[model samples]
Target: MHIQIQPIDYSIILIYVAFVIGIGFALKRYIKTSADFFLSGRSIPAWVAGLAFLSANLGALELVGMAASGAKYGLATCHFYWVGAIPAMVFLAVFMMPFYYGSKARSVPEYLKMRFDERTRCLNSISFAVMTVFASGISMNALAKLLHQLLGWNYDLSLWICSGVVLIYVLKGGLTSAIYTEVLQFFMIVLGFAPVVWLGLKDMGGWVTLKEVLRNVAQDPAKVGLAHDTALASNAMTSAWQPIFSGSSANLMGVDWFAIIFGLGFVLSFGYWCTNFLVIQRAMSAKDMGAARRTPLIAAVPKMLFPILVILPGMIAIGLSYIGKDNYRLPPVAISESAYPAAVETFQKFAAGRMNATATTAALQTIIKPKLSEAKIAALLAADSQQKLDSSAIRNGLQDAVADNDYDGVILSLVKKYCPSGLLGLALTALLASFMSGMAGNVTAFNTVWTYDLYQAYLAKNKNDAHYMWMGRVVTVVGILLSIACAYVASNYSNAMDIVQLVFGFVNAPLFATFLLGMFWARTTSHGAFFGLLGGTLSSALFHGLTLPAGSTAGIKGGWLATLTVFPSEMAQNFWLAACSFSACLTLTLTITLLTKRDKSDNELTGLVYSLTPKVKEHDLHWLARPAVLGTLLLLACLILNIIFW
Candidate 1:
């Protein structure tokens, strides 16, 4: 498992780190006030902000988790982008950006305060600030773990190195430095992964050969670790739409089309892209409203093609495993005398868990015969037939092996195996770029919310601009330190994506409901907004708690008050969780708005709510320059992709 790091690779990484720091120091002169520090003086261009917008989101979770999901679920994993992301990006550009950009609100929570009340803003600010810090930490932890696993670096050293680089750049130039570096990181990632997909496709004999090999692997029950059945596995791995509507247990994703459409496509997608300040801050920093409106749309072009870089690596890994690639194939070993009983017990437990004991026994024989003595295997099978062992204890032991789902490590494996020393360094640096971009984005967002929303608004009202600017710098340092602590905490969790989605279910899912009501429905009272937000958050917590027993092993354990239900899979549960929370927030907000008084007048609500806002005249602009036109084009592209993949 040890990988030799070449001098060239280390040098490339060092150069990347220095270049990032240089950018930070280069932009330090621009920060004369808190606004300049946090919002880049609201003067970034559409193209720059657009790439940063996408890069801010192209973190360890998107890179590692999406690839892992691709290996596990096949082409269906593209749903994370095609279905769950693009439409939302377009929606934010067309409908939400007008309020987000034109209102001149300092942050997303600040907008909530202007539209709703201080309580609602506070709720959002505190939750968002906390989540960003933790998310930054998660990115740090994932980077450290990857470096340790791939390059033989110490975990703490890796954590310090990565976090330090992010802190220097973000602390020096603040958002401007972060955004510019993010642009650089975006290119780095593209250069790094592009060759990986090319090499992989070349090795696998192109797309057609790869798909045929995958289908052949699917038909073999002995290769069931990659997929279940011939028809289901082949279609799930090759086609997106074919298996989406199948029963829960039929498809690899374990959710039907209903959940994918309403839950993921509509609810969770809009919630994150529209309401999450981590990304919205990027667009808000644009030089003008038109630039802001175009940021997400501009980002969408690369986003549509990202699956080839990220998800395809996993698909390639799975394909490589079938072709006996040294890194992808399982290693050979003979069972030790002491380990024989334990291994046999593991196979027996797997057998007993299934209803068809005869078929299970046959499968177990095929898997274990090479590693175990016939007598030992026979003894275990006889013991299982007689019901003479505790299936739970045996199952627990087997779970230990299953828990090491190193699907996330497939990309790292590809890098070490296929990349030469110089290229290896570049590839590794791309990973470092993704981690730093994720961390910097979160830290920048956290500092702004803490400074403008909480400190300036509540803790120290009427503070001088210089004082707040100083506080912003100080918070930047504090935020990175706190994120390091959170990174350590995150190390205890299993998969990066699962924990992130859990946080989204609790926070983003319901918050979007409040934003949806506030932006469109002027009748939404402050009380309705506040309580509905509270209600949505609680419902998310309740739904998550009820499904804890059925949730991913990666989730936080033992805090659930009760397990009232089970789910087909964690992803399906998460989608439903958002759907339920969104419905709860929408229902509560509407009902409470009807019962409460309208606190803000139409004049006060001008430019904030849709009905109260004046119509924007766009006839003067060229068709391509119009946000509506750009948004429509993006939506059409997404539809075509879905149809082709379908």
Candidate 2:
């Protein structure tokens, strides 16, 4: 479970950390105004902005969460990138980036203010600022947990050290520092994880053997653990398309094509990629409109290929467990009888990840039934197959429970098992970079939005730019501190990825609809935009309140009202929540737009609204070099990859 950090390895990590701090200090001279601190002075080149755009997202969300999901959902986890990311990213590049960059608004919320009104801007800024901090906190939590679990470092101390390095760099260099650092992190991650996939696949006798090993794990009952479904276990694990083709019964993600397509692909994907300020801030910092439009497009090329670096490691970890080359095993997660009912969703998640829901449920049954008396088991089974097993004696009977694989630790554990001393340092550094990048991306975005969108907009207009720049630095510390507090909040969750998507559903899903209407539909009034946003957010909360996931209690995961419906899994719930939010927001925005008067004239909407603005024509050498052309090629490439995998 732990990697022994040699002195050389420690030296490598320390050197990287020192360089990170040095970059921040070096960039300190550039911070004259709030814009300089927050926006990188709009001077970054396209390629740098593009990589920074992509790297901003490569944090723990990619390195750990994707690996964890890959371990849990099998190949279907690729859907997050192939379905959920590529298309949205393309949309951002080709369609949305123009408005974002051309409007000259400091942040996404400022764009909303420019297009709509102050109330809308205020609402978005507040929510975005809050969400960024929480998102930042999740990254911090993942980093701290990684260090604590793998290196046996103190958890609290890890949080401080990780956050401290990021704080120093971001505090000095601001977005400029974070962006360049993210570029470095990007290469580190690739260099760090590329070998992981190579070493794993090579050890298992390459690609064919990797699949065979995974297939073996999927079909074996003893190895299947809580996974009970045997029929499509291999298919679900090995083939992404097969599970959906067989319907929800075989879908490893517990979501049908409709939910996968509309919920995750369209709603959640577009919501996060287009509107979330973290990634958008990178694009928004581009030197010109052409570079801005190209920022996400440039990032898309590598993004399409990142799964190999991230997801394969997790799959390799599981496959390695079945390989006789090493004594390493997937880390085990113990579920107490008291915690089992609450952890039903968690258990089914990874068990089903072995391939299909039936196996997960059956394996879950196998783990518990052995400890309970026949009568107690019967009673529990009679009441919804042990889901509502709340009796004291029944819980007492289930004292000796089984532990599941710690899916979240799959990638980090791989580093421990397979990597050599020096390579281990690079891998560790790469992981640390990803964690810091994700955290810094959020913190940078948070400070910007807090400074320009919230503080200057309403708090104090009389404050000079120097004062606002000072506030930006202050909020950097404030954001990281708050993120530390939120890390403890994140520590409660079983899946960091699921919680992130859930947060996006609440904050970003409805907001995308707002942007869509405001940009393209010039008729969308401030009243419509503001209330539509409110309606969408409320609907998401309302929907979540009414519906509970199958293996969960009635709490934050939903059913706070009454359990009107139950989703198959938490992932499914998150998808549907986003879908509902988007639909509600769009409908409400349209309905309210139809009823309300348009406050802004066509003149005022000129650069802000897409339809009202002139078509962007880049003064470039060739058509292929243009953002749209590049974007089209990227989409085609993405489609080809999807089909090849399918």
Candidate 3:
């Protein structure tokens, strides 16, 4: 794993780092006051906001985790970006942004406060803030682990490098530096992954060879096509292949088209686009409401295309395994059991011939080391069969010889192998940029919640700009340390994304359900929000506790329910995890809303039904129709690509 120090890689990474630092420093002048620092004085442009949005979403864990999943499953995993995320995003732009901007809230919880009551705002803000810390820590720990593994650096050192660098500029200039740096990071991520994809495809002997190889390896022709049975089956349980699907059992019925359309697909999308502080911060920084909405809409096109940027590389990695590419595939599953048969044969052959016994045993051990456990073999023999068996019995009896493997590592190894020097540098920089962008967003959101919800609302009722700004910096420092501690804890967890999102689901799922009800259901009370949040979270956690212990497997309880089952699969966990959360939240919200004392405010009642209002002056608002048409066409384009490439 020792890399030959390439001066070109060093230079490219150095230049990228310098560029980011330059942007951070350059943006410092905009921070004249606390509002300017935290919100960029509401003056950012659409394009900057757009790029920053993409960068904030992309991260090193995204690169590694996605590529790893692609390598493990196939093109099916790309659904998270393409089918799951994009349509939802477009929905966000067309329908949700207007409500958020038009409302003129500083944070999402602020919206809750305005929409519901102080208690709901405080509850959601604290939950979301804690969630951000947990999520950000996982991302940080993952990136740190990857860097540590890739560059032979210590994990703590890697974590410090990532957390410290982002914290410095963020604490210095807040959202202004975050936005500017993210634009550069977006380009870096694109530059880094794009060429590697090209090279992987080239190495696989082009698309035709890739097709041939896939046909050979998969033993199925339909796997390469959209709606292919094998692909669908592999991705069946989790809409990891498409956001519109899920599975359920007797204990839980899985997400249907409705759940996806309304819950994650619709609710999560609108929630993220309009309310997620990190995303809305960019919009909030915009000089006007039009730009706030337009920035996300502009960003939507690339958000749709991100599968091309991120997922395709992993798909290309899968394609690489065909056409005689050894770099991608690790040894097959059955190899662990079968390996000793071949090894023992070789050993017997050598012993009969001329190799020394000790030498032969050493060689046999080397060959069999990864496949057979000696204890398992001994136990198999010790079980006393009908007739006593000898060494030959042990060798021939071996049944399982699976090569234990790690696909995430495989993609990185491929990157190091085939990605040329300058491109390698670009890839590393892009990954770091993504990492920084994601971390910065998480940290920014954490500070936003802490400052707005706790500091201003509770701690200091009459603070001036200077006092609040100082508190912002102080809170940022404290938040960074807490995140670092979370990262340390996360170092021991497998699949950082899964763990982070699971924790998020357990907490945020209820919140998402409650918020949806609060905004749309006027009867939803503060009592409903509170109890709904608690009930939804507790129920999901209970289900998770029941099903998660057994290792993930296939063809069992399929999908995310499978994950929450004793048998886990990637989709299984996500599906049921979401199910538990959403159901608990919704059921509780409704039940409590019906029973609780309802608020009588006219504004509150009217707001719930606002979108249903007909445009009284349709002719006067005709200008809005053009963007709607354009946005539809854009959405259609993305759909066509999904049909073609999916």
Candidate 4:
């Protein structure tokens, strides 16, 4: 929908921007060395580092992509938080943080280098550098798309503005700036997005009534003109755990308990949380090993409740349509070829400017509106169930339902609908803050990996601190430029989370297996780690190439090699492919390590290997303050939440 921003909104956004830039200037004087620029000189306290750790992950993907997934997958989206993130964060804090912090490795790749071989390090560094840029680009794409969808801003213009702000702050204060700004973004995101959720739920009566509406919308998503998750139900979309056990055919997500537990819960979650440098960098910048270990654990608390902020809005947005509030249907999408030909014709007509925007949207929605008739929707709205919103007024803001539905815009659309002028600016700033946080986090990560892992390791040696610091700042600019290029590539996908999972599948899935072997199994040779990573990544591609999601074409979405099997959904395919990658990597690494001789002695492994590393003495801390105790409590809380939501 077209949104009209008032002067108050613009002023709020400007003030927020000024504040972040000022933070960079405030911290600039402290950036004295490459360590300061890249790793915050290891001085940030536990709380700041912990919030930054979570906020960095709560970027564009967390806001836009999670909301999109919520609309498409329903309560199953909570899996990303409760199942996927919490377990991994707990594991990272209790098990992995010691190696990352105690070893004093500059980055995740550097950790790999110390643990394995230069070949392994080189492969990881390059792949990681590329992955960071891609992630940053995805963040950029979400920001640009949001502005375009809501405010009619030019995509390129919004992208550069977001990148430029991120670049300025990061270039000036380095990782410290990014981390501190992320802390600020964390607050802004919560304060800003709170209104939309509160107002949306208030307008819909309460959670109880909203559930009634969600049950209706979930059973027939296309009844509200939704493009994704076209075949889900109340059981699959409304419950957190039921659909998982319902079997693939019974659930729209098309995955069983095994896929959810193994693929997502174990491999994908650990790979991203334990190993990905983007979030790990925040912990690595912590002032001490204690703070570093607590980083992810601290991040997990708010993360447990984030579904209310991010996911509920998407459900509410579609629910509004079902309850006849403002005629708030999801926008139509560019039809997949497997769908109706008439919808494609309508979309093309709108694309080619052969029809008026309003008329084209209505016609397109009608074609794709499914068999759920208008009478059923009218009767349901008039039925006077528990849904107690003002049902008399149904404004057809069909202008928003154009030929394309950027599901990433779900949260933004809600802000446009429910937020007042002052709150609108705040909400928009929150979106902007999240975008910058994601971009800056990845850019900072990219610079560190490039400067230390690749440039210093291979291209140059023994560089002075001044030279390395300069390179770090220079690489930040290069990363921004590369990220802009990658943003265009990201714009091709509808679901931001889908593309993110796909990237993680290729990069982190196999890398996790390699890291697992190297850290615990000291017998793992460099040759084994290197080839295992390569083979794992290649295996992920092969599995993806051989399998095609149902109702999907064979290309970038997979099955380019040949469609040997068809998955019920792209997400399910991602899960299985990641499982394949992890299994292949672990097997290959073990087999190769058996034949290869270890070049480094057990004594050399020291802090780098878990078996060799000394157990951390926690006698100094209070019982509640200990990382293990806190992490156990956190997991218990998470388990309670899962059961409550189930």
Candidate 5:
């Protein structure tokens, strides 16, 4: 499908980019030291930090990829927010924040070093830096793909434009610039997509109409050419909780509630929200400990509402397609040579019968003219007799032709179809903003890890603050360059979320166990923490490898060793893999700590470990203003949402 890009759209995008760059340059003078460059001088307010914390994770993947999943899996995708995100955000705010903020750790890895040892910190720092670069590339790649598909923009040009913009601003203002731009992007994204969802619902005749259409389509597999049975498809599309406990093969998400709760909710969620410095750095930049603690909690409010802006577009697109209002449809063409002969014969027979029986042949001719002509039908039949078609190939081609799975394009397609030119510019700009926010977040995190955790701490420990600050700027440029390379590599992957989850499984999944033990269990010796982390990471890789399908290169393909066993779905396999890895890490860490020498004194562990840390004295703050109160409210809200949606 060709999309016409209006001049207004280009102008709006250009203005947005310029404004963002201006913010970066405006904040340049603030980077007087490495801490200022990396941590925003720890002067950010709770609200600003909160939004940035949310925006950091709201990259191209969240917008495009989640929309794609919404179309594919229906309401079940809400698990990413309700179960996988909210609880973890609350945990980070209420439980983990004290240590993260009180310990004066510059990065998550730095925390590891203080809690565990230098080796563990090095392991985390290297892995996190690599992950951030790769993640930034993925966001960049997704943005380029969206622009190319939606606006007919050149892919390479899009990449260059976005990368250059992100690089300029992030280099100038560092984390402060990134956070300020993120806050701006957060507003732009909401303003941009809120109308899209409103307009979509309006076009689709509102919520009831959409659900009705989806239900009708789900009940008839032939309508959407779905492979699943009627009941499965209908329930999968309409209800969030009804099919969650069923076999993975029965639901579109390919996972049961057990996996959702344990794999995603417990392990992956905690690991990411708690330990991933890419996002935690935003909270760490807050003006005070209370602000830092409230950052994720503040962010969680909007985070919970994102599915409406991001996921609903895909759901609306799917609904429109079912109701025959969407432009996306299977082409009016046949795949099989043998089927073509029969089709032509049937048309010919119908034409001949109508001609003989009808008083006016003109009427019959008019009825069939747009679809097929007698001459064309005869030609098709003649060609069919002359050529042979492979039945299997024809079947596969037909399946591919009919499956409406370019879900990632759903939102872009909707914007072109429904949004007017001026509004289209705003929506497109919002998309660009989201991609920039995601990339900038990762790039900023990368620079900090590279400069402080890796370079300064290990390679140039004796360097002055001024030299390190300059190196921070230099490393920011290097980070963006590496991210651009990774973006090219990311284009090869089919699913942005899947590849990201795989990376989390590799790094975050195992690392969370170490953090969990070290923070809560005083017996967790540095040797034990280090070895357990190593063991956990290895076990994650081993489980992942063991589950690879016969020909797949990434993710758990299926069953153990791709043959000895089989899983219900790739998602289910991944969750189980994470659960196993977490258990292994916890077990190994405990066992190792029992055998190894412990830390010399509780004094050394003060403010870092739970048992040794002093309890924070209560402040004369309002009840509602407390982190614990806010966290409870957020958790309750999440639970209520789940129950309502369930």
Candidate 6:
């Protein structure tokens, strides 16, 4: 925690802030109409959209979470980067983006309204708004927590600092401003983290030392890669240690395979890439359909490389710990309510000498000083053994400090202890930039929905362009305030990411089902879209409520409801949740379609459905088929990984 914040860090951050604000105001020239504000006048270049998409997705959550995963899961956590994301994105570029762009809709709900009816659009818009709010709030909370932890700033102050920066840019330039800022951030953050990771690897004695370290930790001198124990499996706790999904008994729900592949891979991927307003909005701003389609694909290649910068350093950190016990320092101290031993022999000596606040702090520093040194501070680690590794010192020292808690503190400790001063500041700045990108995207999406779908559609149906633009600005400010309040509320929640993703699933999953049916099935009715959405959402919520238990492995399995882990023994939690919700909603959609009087044809819709029914322009349907193919291939690859790990 003894980070020396240099003036250079402050300077860099200040310049970065000014540049962001400047971009926002500069984009004011582009804000000629509602279309321009929301979609960059639909004229953003593909290259810009590509960078923005990457930046939007690579926010603070991914940076911290990937690092945490590296500390916990070793090389296998990179699956999220490669197996999960790359193919999904390629799918988005080739298949989904065209559908969205060809539809020529301003927003996803607007597209839905064109595809279904007014009722469906309204329902989707509200759900999307709520989801965006929850997601943005938690992400903001994450950014604030990291800022406080890294900079010694107050959490509330950090929250405002973050909100202020994002607001200026997004409010000034709209989507155009957000996209350009995102591109700048993409470069700054990636550049900031890359060298730190490279240096950390060097400190660990390079790749040769890294192999030995991993071999030692695995207690297998021959095996060079990450450790795998098929017997260990992918339970909540076990997945933390082993990257492989099927090594343990915890893969009972096929979560090891199915959850990542079908559930996370297919459902979550498409939802974010094609449907989520925050991400798709970047594409929507493209000057034409081609730029929109190519932008995400361009982003995909960089995203594939991002995990290395984000995750590998933490793995190397853990590996470093096993190389030489004396040379390797203990991780951070974890506090718990457990009563401290009244007088440990070692502590008694310090206490007897009357170690007060300054003395106590100094003593702790002395103990940790060796850990900060540049040299390989190896000492006589074992008396009875030739191996210069002291297991007792390392284990006993860390065990007392981190007793009963998980190893989350370890990674943070390493960052504080080893990362250099300027780099530390840069990293913190990068994290802030990353955090703002997410918050900005969320706020932008929320504002767009409020302005177009709700305000234009209902509140001020006949408003002039100037009035609408002003309203958009006002709603954005109000949304920012609401987001801050939500962030404060979210700070009290446990496992904030898990909560965010799950609530997101509960709300957004039904919409996914509705949209998919609406797109593929012509029999899909307005009534179908309405009840399908309702049934899918309610059923998912019920399923989540009834079955999910404490300490679940799947990301979407934790909640306040999970605390009461009492359920019938017949069904796996996720299966019932997914199946019941998907089936119920699907059936409801079909039943409603059959029951309802014929409303209108796809010809009546303004977007992609128009192409289907010859209502809109007939350019090409080939692009729309690509995501389906790539999704299938990605799903297969996921299965193969599962089998290999199993």
Model 5's C-alpha root-mean-square deviation from the true structure amounts to: 7.7
Better of 2 and 6 by lDDT: 2
Model 2 agreement with the true structure over 1-646: per-residue lDDT tens digits = 3578898888889989988888888988987877889999999999999999988888886678888877766778888889889999999999998889988988998998899899999988887887778777777877787678668899998888888899899988999999999998888889987887788778878878888877776666245342434445676677767677677657557778888889999988898899988999999999999889889989988999988988887777777766645776666553443555644544434433443444434555655533222333333344434354444433433332333566777887878877899889989899899889889999999989998888887888888788998999999999999999888878876566455646556877787889889989898999999999999989998998899988789876889999999987777888888899999999999999999887999999999988889989777548788877888898899889888878
Could you arrange the candidates by lDDT from highest to lowest?
4, 1, 2, 5, 6, 3
Q: Which stretches of candidate 4 lie over 4 Å from their true place?
A: 226-233, 334-405, 489-504
* lDDT, candidates in the order shown: 0.81, 0.80, 0.64, 0.82, 0.79, 0.65
Superposing all C-alpha atoms, what RMSD in Å does each candidate have to the true structure? 6.9, 7.9, 8.1, 6.4, 7.7, 7.9
Off by over 4 Å in 3: 220-275, 322-402, 492-501, 546-570, 604-627
For candidate 4, list the clashing residue pairs, or say none.
none
Model 4 Cα lDDT, one tens digit per residue, 540-630: 8889889998888998788999999998877789889889999999999899889988878988899988899999999999989998899
Residue 347 in model 6: lDDT: 37
Error of 3 at 473 (Å): 1.2
Model 5 regions more than 4 Å off: 225-233, 326-404, 492-504, 548-562
Residue 268 of model 4 has an lDDT of: 91
Across 489-581, the per-residue lDDT of candidate 1 in tens digits comes to 787755554566476558788878899999998899999999998899888888887674344452363136666666777677878888999
Q: Please estimate how well model 1 matches the true structure, expressed as its whole-model Cα lDDT.
A: 0.81
Model 1 stretches astray by more than 4 angstroms: 220-224, 227-233, 330-404, 492-504, 548-565
| Most accurate candidate by lDDT | 4
Q: Count the backbone clashes (under 3 Å) in each candidate.
A: 0, 7, 17, 0, 2, 10
Local error of candidate 1 at 431, Å?
0.3
Cα lDDT over the full model 5: 0.79
